[model samples]
Target: MSLKYAVLAALHEQPATGYDLTRNFRTRMANVWNASHQQIYRELAKMTEEGLLEVEEVPQESRPDRKLYRLSDAGTASLATWLAEPQGRPPTRDPLLVKLFGGDLVDPASLREEIERHRRNWQEELGRYQDIEAEYFSKPEQVPFRFRLQHLALRKGILAMEANLAWADEVAGVLKDELTSRP
Candidate 1:
């Protein structure tokens, strides 16, 4: 999906300044989509020009005025239409997987180290996901019905991290055995 749709969905939650949207992308929406602040600000401007977003300037006493963006009527309809359309899984394009496919050329030990690094990253992310689950979804049933889907999205991330960790461990084990058997 395009980043435009992600931006629309974020604004649909609530109006926000470009900075706030960037922060949300780094935190709340990190698992779903990744975009730089520049990309986000640029998209905001384009959407505003396209009549998909409405920008309201809020005055501030000390700092410069802030531009808050909200989804326009057209944006709402656009988002709804996109949501109703069926989605297919996008193809995965992970560099690590590609590297693993030709692991025989590289030193097995070095490849294992790279896999370990990825494993550590996945572990760290999994911990963060668990923290979010505990803080927001401790009592799932008590959560508002509207947010259940958000929780489900988090679940998807959690499961994905778990799967990656499992796969990495298995690959690392195979590489370790190969290294041990060599000498």
Candidate 2:
């Protein structure tokens, strides 16, 4: 998905300054999309020029003026149209998987170390997903629809991590057995 659509989606909830939007994106949309601060600022300017979003300047006493953005009618319509379209499958680009596929080219010790590292990474991700789920459950009434969507996404992520961890464990087991049985 384009960064414009993601920004529009975030603004759909409420108007927010660029900094606020960046922080929100990090928390709510981090799993699905990511944008650097510079990218977001640049997009905000471009989107404003395109008339897709409206910016309102909020004066501050001792700080720089904040330009809060809200979705214009055009932006809302654009987002709605995009949402109606079918989503394409995400392309896979996993370096670890590629390395694993080329296992025979690497030393056995290095290969095993990589697998162990992957297992640890997945375990950490699983923990983060579990924490997100718990936080969502704390205020169910505040985000009924969003909570459901988040839960579903978290479920898929957790399952994927679990599967990766399982595969890594199995590979590690085989490698250990082979090393021990070497004549």
Candidate 3:
């Protein structure tokens, strides 16, 4: 999905400044979609020009004025249409899988190190997912539908990480066996 749609979806819940949107993306949307602050700011500008989003300047005494963005009627309609469309297959681009496919030509020590690193990353990701889950459980009633979508994404991420960690451990075991049996 395009950043425009993501931005529109975020604004659908409530109006927010660009900075607020950025924080929302990082904390709540990071599992499903990622966007840099610059990208979000640029998309907000484009959406404003396209009449999909409306921006209001909120004056501040001690800081720069904030431009709060809200979804226009066009933006809401666009988001509804996009959400109604069927999702296509996601493109796969796993760098670790590419490296593993070329394992026969790789140095055994280096491959083992890479696998260990992947295991660590998965562990960290699992922790993040667990945190999200915990937060959801803490306030079931307050959880929004969009946040529910994010929770599902986090569940998928958690499972993916578990599978990766299992695969890495198995590969490491095989590599160890090969090294020990080398004649």
On TM-score, the candidate that comes out on top is: 1
Candidate 3 worst ten-residue window by lDDT? 132-141
Candidate 2 vs 3: which has more lDDT: 3
Backbone clashes in model 1, listed as residue pairs = none
Which pairs clash in model 3?
none
Q: Clash number for model 2?
A: 0
lDDT (Cα, tens digit) per residue for candidate 3, span 21-42: 9998887666767999999999
Q: Write the per-residue lDDT of candidate 1 for residues 7-105, one digit (tens) a residue.
A: 999999899999999998877777888999999999999999999999999999999999999999999999999999999999999899899889899
| lDDT tens readout by residue for model 2, 143-183 | 76956776676678778888988898889997788667767
Query: Runs in model 3 with CA error above 4 Å?
Result: 139-146
Q: In lDDT terms, which candidate is top? A: 1
Worst 10 residues of 1 by lDDT: 142-151
Model 3 misses residue 117 by how many Å?
A: 1.2
Better of 1 and 2 by TM-score: 1
Per-model TM values vs. the true structure: 0.95, 0.85, 0.89
Candidate 1 structure lDDT: 0.92
Q: Rank the candidates by lDDT, best first.
A: 1, 3, 2
